[model samples]
Target: MTRRILLFGATGYTGGLVARALLERGEVPVLVGRDRAALDRRAAEIRPSDPPYTMVLDVHDVGTLRRTISADDVIVTTVGPFHSHGRTVAEAAAEAGASYIDSAGEPPFIRWTFEKLGTRAANRGARILPGFGNEYVTGQLAGAWALERAAEMGVPHRLEIGYFSTGGSLCSLSRGTIASLAGSSLERSYTYRNGIRAERPGARSSSFRIGGRKYSGFSIGTTEHLTLPEVSPSLQELDVYLGWFGKASPLLATASLAGPLIRRLPGAKRVVSTVGARLGGFGKDGPESHERDRSGVLVSARVFSKSKHKLSEITLAGPNGYELTASLMAWAATVESHASTRSVHRRTGVLGAIQAYGLGVVRDTCLHLDVREVESAVVSA
Candidate 1:
């Protein structure tokens, strides 16, 4: 069978961007979605030299979804608020033994991908990669690079990653992202301390100094908690933070301390989900090209020695989150489609960005996407 790339949710905002990116690279991905008209419109907009094949099927229909995917196909999905809509598609890919990629950032969904689906996918020889987007991939690469450098000094015990963005407002986020955040706001997140441990979102706060300015972020669960430790065995603790809220981060952190109580309130989850969605502009089309272009992202990863002294730090600066996400998914899908590259790594099951593609390749890809390393420091004892 001829290997093909399948773009699910191709009619959505990020999916459309991924489609365009793939076409620009001279690859024609089959657009798969429930709406034929939207898919047709997207295909027309891209105007690939070859008439792009389109598949119309409800992703919720597990039977059809499984049938549609093949072992030889690479599936890129952007349909999310993943905790709600992502499982069916992900399961189909795992069962079909197809290479799967998604833009999920929800902590619970990510955990489920690794803890529940990891073994099943591995058994089937499927490579399941969650958070192959800006939400976590950028930080994962940064953390991996830091771990590599810190290993030279001595065994590292702690890894901390911070994500910051500039020149963009909340309007830059897609409806899907907003909804995902809303859905997961009250859920318990995890971190790596000795091992995976439950933690309240925003329960901890961290600050980083970059370019001589201070940025503060609230702690959150990320793929880094699961993947970074594998890069360095001596790691005893890992924390990932998001500084997008800026001055509001402390307020958010304070509110999060009551998470356990608030979550227990009758109907609290539904209430928060609804309010968050509306407040976040869940019905909008997200920011325009100019707005996205006006934004940039910075990710910092710092590794510390057993004695609690910082050993190494790596920082990467990149384009807007959405744009980089689309580009990264496209680049990853292309790489997975090639048999030679797949064989070289031969990685199966749920994987972190570094595990899916080695640190060298991820670093090179970041450079190509203008996500160059802006700083690297190795401190002496």
Candidate 2:
């Protein structure tokens, strides 16, 4: 049973890592991207026991890409600016009945995926699993853990899961993700309450401290805002806090308030990218820098119930955001390649990573790859 994987964006930082992971794991993926020289170079560098194939294909050509994909194959894509390049890949994978997975974090891109390709993919028995990367996987896992504790205690009304990262994000954090913050006023912050979504904008704010520094936080972004409701019906309030600790936290928070306005202006990416590029990089010295680029998620959740079981805080951290993302994507592809998870085929509606992959599987993958999980318990008042 030869499972041919069609990997788009193989030339990218994360994509290259994904390709390497697949080859190293004994899965021969047909790496596809626009760069032949880069792909060839990467293929030469990969120390696979055997060998992997590389192809020069533009995902924008949905027809050709789909025709090339087969039912037995799986598609792992890491190309972002997903708003510009993801749908075609998903559509092709769905039409060909190939299982599709990608690392998409922007809310709009995902919203479009659900609206346009979700049903088609499901109907064809092809699973379109999004956010298999960093955004919601860890947070969703934390949500599941909170719900389990809530059910055990009884009267589980709300769960607050805050994600604090002292990490360097991949260059994939596109203008859209930043722009999503601008639209924070579009809807009130929401969390699931007894299997229903409840909105609470006032509860969304900043000024949280993690890793010995104060970082600014905000209510924008759809990961916790959207996925928590489905992962845990008992959670009425889900607030995802990013960059909530550090001397620069307040500035980041203030910028979040102006995200919409700032993004509206021209040259936004140019300005941001130039400044970010000039920052050179977070060196190996700072702990926060260690946390960021190394790929670590700090999940501090407070579960409310009778006797309030303030469960242990958990942190999943690893080496390099892009590399971890690629590894995770590769792992997801391997899992989907096997028809063993037949239940995933029957899953029709839009699904989150935790629901689709399971917490233990995700947790273990993170761990096997040196993703550190730190835990601490707190007593209820």
Candidate 3:
């Protein structure tokens, strides 16, 4: 059986970008989505050399989805707010023993993908990798590098990662991204403090200095909290923060302080979700191409020894999040599609980029995407 790549949600903003990136690499993925007209429009827009093939399938139809996948196929999905719509597609991929990748940033959904679906996928020979996009992959790569350098310390370490956007704003976010954030705000998040523990988004606030300027970020759950420990057992605590709010970082932290109390109120979660959705105006599209071109991404990772001394710090600078996400997802899908015939053995399970492709491959791929190491420093004993 010839292995193929299938892209689900091919008509959405991020999905279309992924399709274009794949086409640029000479691999035309079979576009899969429920909207035939939209898929046709997307295919027309990209204009691949060969007439692109498309399949109309509702993600809710689990049985049909499972039946449509093959053991040797690769599935890349961008249909998200994943806590609600992702399980079916992920489960189907796992059941069919197909390699799966998704543009998921929701912390709860990511955890579920690892803890719940991981065993099943591994048992079925499926390599499931969620949060493959800008949401966490860059941080994962930086953290992996820092951990590698910190290994010689021979003591438990704490990892701190901060995500910052130098030229983007909330206006640049897509409707799907807005909805995901709104829905995720009402869900429980976690952090790794010796072990996984429940935590609220924005519960903690910290800062990072880039280009000699300090920027504040609020804590949020990210896949790094779950995958970094597996990379190095000496990891004792992990914290991931997002500085997109810029100066409003402290305000978000103050609001999060009320999360525990608000969550206990009758119907508070529903009310908040409803208000957020309305405020986001889900029907609108994301920023225009020029706006995206104006944006850039920065991810920083710091490792600290148990004795309260900083071991090393690494920072990566990259293209806009959406653009980088498209390239990253396309690269991951291509790698997975060829894994069976490659010399290196591919592990089947929920994995980070380093676990799936190794550090050198990830570094090279990021470099190709213009995501490079902008800063690095190691402290001596």
Cα-based TM-score, every candidate: 0.94, 0.76, 0.93
- Extract clashing residue pairs from model 3: none
Off by over 4 Å in 1: 48-51, 281-283, 340-345, 376-381
TM-score comparison, 2 vs 3, better candidate: 3
Could you list the CA RMSD of all candidates, in the order they appear? 3.2, 5.5, 3.3
lDDT scores in order? 0.86, 0.60, 0.84
Candidate 3 residue spans exceeding 4 A from truth: 152-156, 261-283, 341-344, 376-381
Span of ten consecutive residues with least summed lDDT in model 1: 372-381
lDDT of 3 by residue, 235-351 (tens): 889999988768887788778777777888898766776666555524555667888899888888989988878888788988889999999999888877767733346588788
- What TM-score number comes out for model 1? 0.94
In the range 37-96, model 1's lDDT, one tens digit per residue, is 988888887784556889998878988988888789899999877887899999999998
Position 184, candidate 2: lDDT: 35
Off by over 4 Å in 2: 48-51, 166-204, 207-216, 262-295, 305-319, 340-349, 377-381
Name the lDDT of candidate 1.
0.86
Q: In lDDT terms, how accurate is model 2? A: 0.60
Q: Write candidate 2's Cα lDDT for 73-112 as tens digits.
A: 8889877656557888888877877778888765566656
